[model samples]
Target chain A: MYCVETDHLTYRFARNEPVVRNVHLQVPQGSIYGFLGQNGAGKTTTLRLILGLLKKQQGIITIFGKSFEEHRLQILREIGSLIESPSLYGHLTAVENLTIYQKIHQAPKNRIQEVLELVGLSGTGKKKAGQFSLGMKQRLGLAIALINKPSLLILDEPTNGLDPNGIIEMRELLKQLQREQGITILISSHLLAEIEKLVTHVGIINQGQLIFQGTLPELMSRREQSAGIVLNTSDSQRTMGVLEQLHLGGAVESSGVVLPFVQKEIVANIARELVRSDIAIYGIQQRTDDLETIFMNAIK
Target chain B: MHLLNIFQSEWLKRRRSLASWLVVIGGLFTPVIIFTMRMVYHQRLSLPQKFQLPDFWQVSWNQSWESMALFMLPMGIIMATGLMTQLEYKNNAWKQLHTTPQRMATIFCMKLLIILIMLVQVFVVFNAGLYLFGILPSLLLSSVSYPAADLPVAMIMQWNINFFLDCLPIVGLQYALGLHFKNFLVPFGAGFLLWIVSMSGLTWEYNYILPYSYTMLDYLVLAGRKIRIGTDIHVMSVMYFAVFIVGGYAVYIWKNEKG
Candidate 1:
């Protein structure tokens, strides 16, 4: 069974503008689902809807085969989350902050030390959370998310504002949590490259719509289908004009004009047309195999 | 979670917060001022021919209530509750708190109760400071003598209970305002404005209509300003508290954006 499931989830901030539209998400058990979207692309809004942070306007959200409305507390008891930035009391020490959540979850006292050690924060004694570095604060947030020993962990932009080292540490910690504790994690990020190495499944959102959701390999394999022919021309504007006249769909890029791979005769004809128009041709290449580039293009 | 666990969680959160300090400072401010003034003027009250609990307790109570009931009590509740409520928002912890296993009702009630408890702590400290103000005069000044009648424990306890009741609506009002606004000044400003409006109506025939006026009105009645109105300020305070507290919770539960 899927660990987290949603059906026809739709939400809008204003009446005319929908922030999330008809998103059906399935996060499998024991998998790191990468929720990818650019800023304001509704990734956070979708996660919030699932976590009951925002009221569900039109959707069915279920975790562990239980509806959120029927068993919200029970489902929430089995889940842990860190939305956007870390939410912490700056005045309290690391242990103290974790202790508050421990008491709230009624978790065992020893779990505090265990999770702290898991997050490499056991030595951060007597230091207030406000005094810790940004990376340290992120770890403490993860520790709080783990205090309940939850089976399903939901993190939105968990690695935001982290250095490369912090990102790698978070990736390793999340992997360890899944391998050791058998936890299912659904993590969101705006950049596919950041979570490419860690996620087993990927979901890409853009303009409040789920454009893609599949396994990482499945998403990566999409590069084969999106490969395009690149044209380096002197007068790019005239080249685009000729292509548009010929009903060729092309997008302007910094390197050159890129269009879907076409036959060699068609390319020669285009080159001839460009020459007739007094446009210099520098190079021609057919390549778009970079999955990051493909998805990043799709998201944009 | 059990009530004790929730209480412990809240207690630990405010360890180094402004609300905690407000309780301490707000409680002891009036008494410290009284103590300093007594020492400066070398004031001494002679033992009257007939000295009872009134002579000993009334002097301290009335003197303390002059400022407490008029300004400090209402304004202090406004500020303290604002600080306490803003603690979650200031640290961006409301989303964290909502994601927990606990129910929203439980959190709402426990958080509000914690603010009320903080107010009671202020009352307790202020009461204790009054006793200090009473005793320190005799110790610091050579001529002043200890009152012949002992401290009226039951009377002062009753007095505190009454004052606390009078302050409840203010607590409820500020608590509601604080929960609604993320900025601390919104509630403080609203409370201050309402208190001013409430004070201006003290002479009007329908002055008892305003909840903010209850604290000062109770004091006015105690100081022999007969209102001749049939309405009981204590009952009205309780009623207004119920309205604000319940209305606040209802809005909280019904609203979409919790965190």
Candidate 2:
């Protein structure tokens, strides 16, 4: 069963302008669903709607096989979220801040120490939250979300404004949570590269619409449809002529000769024809589009 | 149990806040200032045998209550409410709080309750300060004796209770303003302006409609008699409290949940 499902979800800040329009999301249980969208693409707004932070004007949201409106409290109890910036009491110490949430969640007192250690903030004794660095603040936010041991975690732009090392740490932490705890995570990011290695499934959104949703491999398969071949020959003009005789048309460019990549057997046939014609083969390579290129094309 | 947990959590959030300190200091301001001024006035009149101290306990109570009702209490309510709500806006914590499993009404009510608790603490501390200052000065002055026989404990308690009830409408209105505006200056300025207008030389009938004037109207000393209770003023105060508290919570829940 899907952990989170939204059907024709719609939202608007003003009367006439709809920020999210008929957007459907399918997040499988126990999968890291990466929500990809450009800035101002309604990714955060959609997350807010699913979390029940904003009232839904249209469509239905179901979580854990229950409608959002019917079981809001129960669903929310099982969910953890970090939206935009970390919500913290800057005047309070790191431990004090976590203690506040722990009391609210009615978790064990020891859970505060556990989450602080999990987020690598145990050593930050007596340091006020406001004095924490950006990366530290993000980690604390994640720690707060994990304090309840929630079944589902929703993080919007969690790695935004973090240094490279901080990003890697956050990525590893998320992976560990999914692998060890079997927790389902729904994370949103505009940079595909940031979440590419961590997410098992992806949903690309554009202009308040879900453009694509599927497994990582299914998204990668799109690149195969647009794949092509490149050959670096000793003699380009002669290679094009030899290809025409074989009923294969190609184009010669600065890199080499370009042709539509069809199958593995076609490469062998092209090689045999070039060797037979005494055109010394310098090199040949097949190129498939990367995920970033595929994402760009899909959004466009 | 759930509401208690929420209240405990809300208290923890402000355990170390500067607002708590400000409330203590603001509460002491009126009583301490009036006590010191009265001490100096008595010292200046030491030579005049004809200038006897006017009922010492009544004078002290009147001075403390007037300063508090006219200026300090209104400003304290405004500051307390502003400080309580500013924490949410400063850290953008409303979004975080809203997404929790707790009902929005529970959260809103818990916060308002905490603010009320803080105001009560201030009121108690201010009375304690007034009593201490009033007693110490009377012991030192030869001409002015503590009116222990004239001022009964029940009378003081009754006066404190009445003043607290009269301030409820101000609490509700300030809290509503604090929740509605993200900028502290706007609510603070509104409270200051309204307070000044309430204290101006407007018609006595205007006090019936103004929440800030309730405290001043509830108790008055005229012609050597203490008018400690006004039934009409108490009724109006209760009505204003119900309106603002219910209306403020409704608006808060609606805006936070939907807007």
Candidate 3:
């Protein structure tokens, strides 16, 4: 069953322009769903709608098979979120901050230290949060979200403003949580490459519309249908003419020819034809599976 | 356990701040200044009335609680108001607290109770300071003059309790103003405006509604019977504490927007 489902979720601010226009999403249980979009593309808005932070003007948001607004508190108990930048009280220490959250959740003190250690924030309990670096603050925010042992963790641009090492650490931590605890994660990122590395399933959204939603393999399969083999040669003009003689409308670049075909046999035939025509093909390459290709294909 | 956990964490957050320490120390200064000023006044008056009366001025340990009204209580209220408003303005503290499973009412009460404890500490120390200063002198002067009247001392003590009760509304109003205004200046300015309006005795009846007005009322009641005639302190305080706390909290919940 889908851990989270939004059926035609629509939201409009008071200005009345539709920010999120009938977006649909289905995140299966134990799936690491990467929500991808550019800035102001309503990724965060959709997450907020699911969390019941913002009311949906027109749609239904079901988390764990329950409506968000009706069971907001109970739903929130099951799902933890790190919305926007980690907004926290600056005056409190790391431990103090965690303690406040634990008190609210009625979690045990042992779990507080355990989460602190898990986030690599142990023994820094005395340091004020205001003094923490951005990376440390982000890690601490993750710790707060993890303290309740939530079944689902929603992170919005979790790696924003982080160093390369910080990003890697965050990615590893998220994967670790999923593996160890079976926690479903819905992480939003504008960078497709980053999500491609960590996410098993992805939902590409553009202009408030969910363009694609499926497993990585399924997305790869879609690209496989439109897959092209690029043939590199010194005489690009001759190669173009030769391909045109073959009645193939392939893309001609400065150094190579891009032949679009679904079948692997078609690529072999094209390669043989090139060799038979005495076309010195330097290289024959098939398109590698990448989110950018799927994203461009979906949006285009 | 939940409230205690919340309070301990909240207290740890503030325990290290410079401003919080200043408030703790500044609270002590209010009573000290008032009591010392009274000591000089008493000395001067004693000199003038020395020939006619031997015991014209007598310093008593019981008068220390009275000194708190002249400075400490109002200052404590102002400090608390500033702290609460600063918490809102400086950070997204309210939103942070609001999102917790703890209800809004619980958070509000937690803050209020903490501030009350801090203020209570200030009062206790201020009273202690006055006692140290006044007790020795009162005892020293007892032999020189006729024995001090215990009745006046007991009456002053009773009036001081009523006086503290009367000041509750002032603290409540300050709390309400702090919560109403998101900006620090408005709450601090309101505290000062309350001070100015309360000190000007032109409209005693209406001005008495102000929390700071109780200081003047405390003075008047202690001075003579004219002020206490028909003014039941107990009933007035009960109404203020109930109405102001409930009213302030209600306004907070009504006006406060959840992020």
Best candidate per TM-score, number? Answer: 1
Residue pairs with clashing backbones, model 3: B170-B211
Which has the better TM-score: candidate 2, or candidate 3?
2
Q: Could you arrange the candidates by DockQ from highest to lowest?
A: 1, 2, 3
What is the DockQ score of candidate 2, to 2 decimals? 0.48
Give the per-residue lDDT digits (tens) of candidate 2, residues B7-37: 8889988777877887788778877787677
**What does candidate 3's lDDT look like per residue over A118-198, in tens digits?**
889997857888899988888888898888899999998989878998888889989999999999999999887777778
Off by over 4 Å in 2: A223-292, B38-42, B45-54, B137-151, B219-231, B256-259
DockQ of each two-chain model: 0.73, 0.48, 0.25
Q: What global local distance difference test value does model 2 have?
A: 0.82
- Chain B TM-score, all predictions listed: 0.92, 0.84, 0.73
First chain TM-score for all predictions: 0.84, 0.80, 0.83
Instruction: Give per-residue CA lDDT, model 2, range A26-105, as digits (tens).
Output: 99999999998888889999999998888789999999989999999999888989999999899998898888788888
The per-prediction tally of clashing pairs is 0, 0, 1
**Backbone clash total, candidate 3:** 1
Name model 3 segments beyond 4 Å from true. Answer: A52-58, A205-209, A219-300, B1-13, B17-23, B34-72, B88-95, B133-164, B170-182, B198-205, B209-212, B223-257
* Predicted structure 3, TM vs. truth: 0.74
Model 3 error, position B195 (Å): 4.2
User: Which lDDT values do the candidates have, in the order given?
Assistant: 0.86, 0.82, 0.71
Q: Across residues B34-92, which tens digit of lDDT does each residue of candidate 3 receive? A: 54654566576462233234222223332443445655567667766567556645655
